[model samples]
Target: MFLNTWSLWEKEPDYNSYLGLAENLDEKGYAVSFGDNPFDDDKVGEKVYMHILNRADKYVHIITPYLILDDGLLMALKYFAERGIDTKLILPGIPDKKAVYALAETYFRTLLNSGVEIYLYTPGFVHAKVFVSDDKKAVVGTINLDYRSLYHHFESGTYLYGAKCITDIEADYQATLSKCEKVTYESIKKEKAFVKLRGRFMRLIAPLL
Candidate 1:
């Protein structure tokens, strides 16, 4: 089932779709959560994502155009990496927004050091938001890895467990990986001061973005 989150800033905040979807998943014994208000700690997108990430056993593959990781999400990914899980992120090689890309780069070194493999998709821009885990669970929706997405935006994604498309999702992930350029600490460290400052500023105010 497809779920959608429409924020009040963009339209009206309608989380009925997500709430209903979560209910369905819950009945099937799949851990799920959804919230319309970002101010409420428990009823927010990040909480839902954290539950999913924490449940991942073997691998977690994420494909997103943006890569602005919040502290909690970053910690979850770091934990998975430290546990020897295959945690991978596929981002855009040529970004649609340079400022966002720069801000995302600021975390590359830290994430790399934590053992999270990062890939930059070549050929064209990667605009999909997908999460696949351990061949049994997946999430496909509009959740970006930025503070705006996790906090301000009323985003929605389908929480799938043993879905038929799981295999196809993994296949797509591998195919996309083939078109990516692996990111390294050395490559992201040579940025100019002004660029770094701008990125840092963007990262600082990501929630307001």
Candidate 2:
């Protein structure tokens, strides 16, 4: 991770400068995986997410501030739910950015219809970027379920497999879910006309977000 960041700031980063640092460090029992972004040909962060979703057996829980998803991710979430994987997403009810929030709402209909549960935190903003799956794997970091985080920005995340902390992470998600109001098709229909229009406009330029 440090080497990846160094390459960004330095005109020419020497990979050999950090060689052999982990030669004596035992990593056998540790299942923590780290990844960073701005990859030239591959979007590693997005791939990590897709991999988790694809490999999930029982459930997948997510907490993200933004929800502007590309077709691939959108389909992946829907597919998981449709296949009865207990998929759920917790988003903020009190948004820091109304425009982005509106854009995020554009996905609710399709997601809800696909049987993917959607919840809105009613207290304040939810800025958590987390993904916990099947009680055995999880990710906690700066990645958001949007185009900017997945494709444009420099981002990183720690993937945990069979880590003790994953239990706590999933517990937190459950606690947060209690504070959220589930969104149904009826609730989506109650949205103001203006907000829907704004969401439509934002969807067209979602990739730039």
Assess every candidate by TM-score.
0.80, 0.86
lDDT of 2 by residue, 40-135 (tens): 757878877887898888999999999999999999999999999999999998999999999999999999889999999999899999999988
Model 2: lDDT equals 0.83
Q: Give the Å error, residue 141, model 1.
A: 0.7
Q: Return the number of clashes found in candidate 1.
A: 0
What TM-score number comes out for model 1?
Answer: 0.80
CA-lDDT, candidates in order: 0.76, 0.83
Cα RMSD, each candidate: 6.9, 6.4
Deviation in angstroms for 54 in model 1? 0.7
Q: Please identify model 2 stretches exceeding 4 Å from their true place.
A: 1-29
